[model samples]
Target chain A: MSLESDIPSWVQALAGGGLIGLSAALLMGLEGRILGISGFVRSVLEADPKLKGPSTAFLLGLVLVGILAQFYFVDTLTNTQPRSYMITILAGLLVGYGTAMGNGCTSGHGVCGLSRFSYRSLIATLSFMAAGMLTVTLHRVLMGGM
Target chain B: MKQQITHFIIGILFGIGLLLSGMTQPGKVIGFLDIFGNWVPDLAFVMIGAILINSIAHKFLMRRGRPLFGTGFNLPSKKDLDRPLIQGSILFGIGWGLAGFCPGPAIVSIGGLQTPAILFGIGLVIGASVFIVKKNQVK
Candidate 1:
């Protein structure tokens, strides 16, 4: 799990970001949709069968990429230090509930929503960022370190 | 049929983008959120690069009227800074900070069959189901 790379992290970030933006652009341009992952998850959960094709397909695509990464880009997708199952599940629960309640996550609000200059997205992004920062700060203080 | 294929392709591109950008890695995500500590600003660049392209695309695509396959753009119309939006975001941030896996990365991880990710995915589904059930009750 080396973070070392020949290319600078910033450049990698930008190129990757461009690909994400391209995904959103193509989805909007061709399908008339916003590529928010949380929203997509919800749609899958509540699929009406008649109109569930796109969401299901999109999710499968994400999964497919994951499988492909394991085979080829293994170095790029390293996992972090393992946490307890309780914490992991708790975090997952929070993410699922929070994204659903908020109606978007980083991709939806931070990327697509902000791209469109939506004030709601901006506020949501700020709130989540602040909360995330605060949580990490508190965790560090309580748990003694990262 | 065509729409589904297009979406699948787009999803693949999006997943690759996440992997390339390091957004799928919890370490990187936590590093970015660790503002006061050894804060990594790499994620910000991801957002900046993405927004630049997306905003430009939105401007042009919106002008084109209807999309290539769909009848109209399915954009969110809500403008109010509502309570659910704020509260939900705060909760989401906490969860994200806890495990450093958001919906996108978690789903991607599940595909990879990682243990932590698989556990998180279960909790995610349960949590999301709670919200859905509650919403139905309210309605």
Candidate 2:
């Protein structure tokens, strides 16, 4: 089903955006850590050996939530074109690398960092946005407008 | 203490935005990225709304000198445009375009256990691991 099949696209889109903002705020307010996925995953992986168990559990909770959503709201979820698993893996790897080198992912920098007015985040976010624009432009040129 | 509280509040608001905008749904994102097959420019509206709200909020925040929770502003110090910056940007762009899910949405999506997201999260973990190791070695 397309976005237009049931609920209005705008309403859905707005709610999604609002939820993201709200969640990030809540995490910060409670945890004091910015909800940057790169950092969160990193901390989970290499956290103190003593904290490893809890860290792993935390990570598991993150995945569990997604799984539950899928189970409960099967119809609302939409799947993208079936690309090869390899391509998806490669993309994820690159993103991981970028987030590490850049010191933050889009959430950490683009949203959280920018909201905090961090100079590093500002540059990173700008770079990320510009790069996205360039990539799409080039992709259209190469893929013939997809 | 105050900073922590602020972050939590900000996180909650951000989460709500994600849910409201349908950003948490991979379909909406993939749909936006699938501009070649069936284009939906509505994603642009979400971006505009965010930018507008953020811009105004930022201005107001700046006027305050200090954030509600923190003693002072927290901003990045790096100003130079260098190799690491450029390369990282390129990598981020490619990942985002291919996956239709950047870090923010990916985290939010985690609340809904989709296969693609799980895969993406795994990849994210491995990628971060490599980066951290390499950084440590350099240091």
Best by TM-score: 1
Q: Provide the TM-score for each candidate, comma-separated.
A: 0.96, 0.72
| Candidate 1 structure quality by residue, lDDT tens digits, B19-136 | 8889888888888999998899999999988999999999999889999988999888889899999999999999999888988878888888878889989988888889999999
Residue-pair clash count for candidate 2: 67
**TM-score, model 2 to reference:** 0.72
- Highest lDDT: which candidate? 1
Residue-level lDDT of model 2, residues A1-146, one tens digit each, is: 23345667775665554454445544443433455666656665667554344334444444444454456644444554434577667767888888777777766776666666666677877787666555555555676655
Give the range of the ten consecutive residues with the poorest summed lDDT in model 1 chain B.
B105-114
lDDT of 1 by residue, A50-122 (tens): 4478888988999999888777777656766566899989999999999999999999999999999999999
Q: How accurately is candidate 2 docked according to DockQ? A: 0.34
In candidate 2, position A109 carries an lDDT of: 74
Per-prediction DockQ: 0.81, 0.34
lDDT of 1 at B87: 96
Model 1: residues >4 Å from true position, as ranges? A1-4
Regions more than 4 Å wrong, model 2: A1-7, A22-35, A46-65, A113-123, A130-146, B1-16, B33-38, B53-74, B108-111
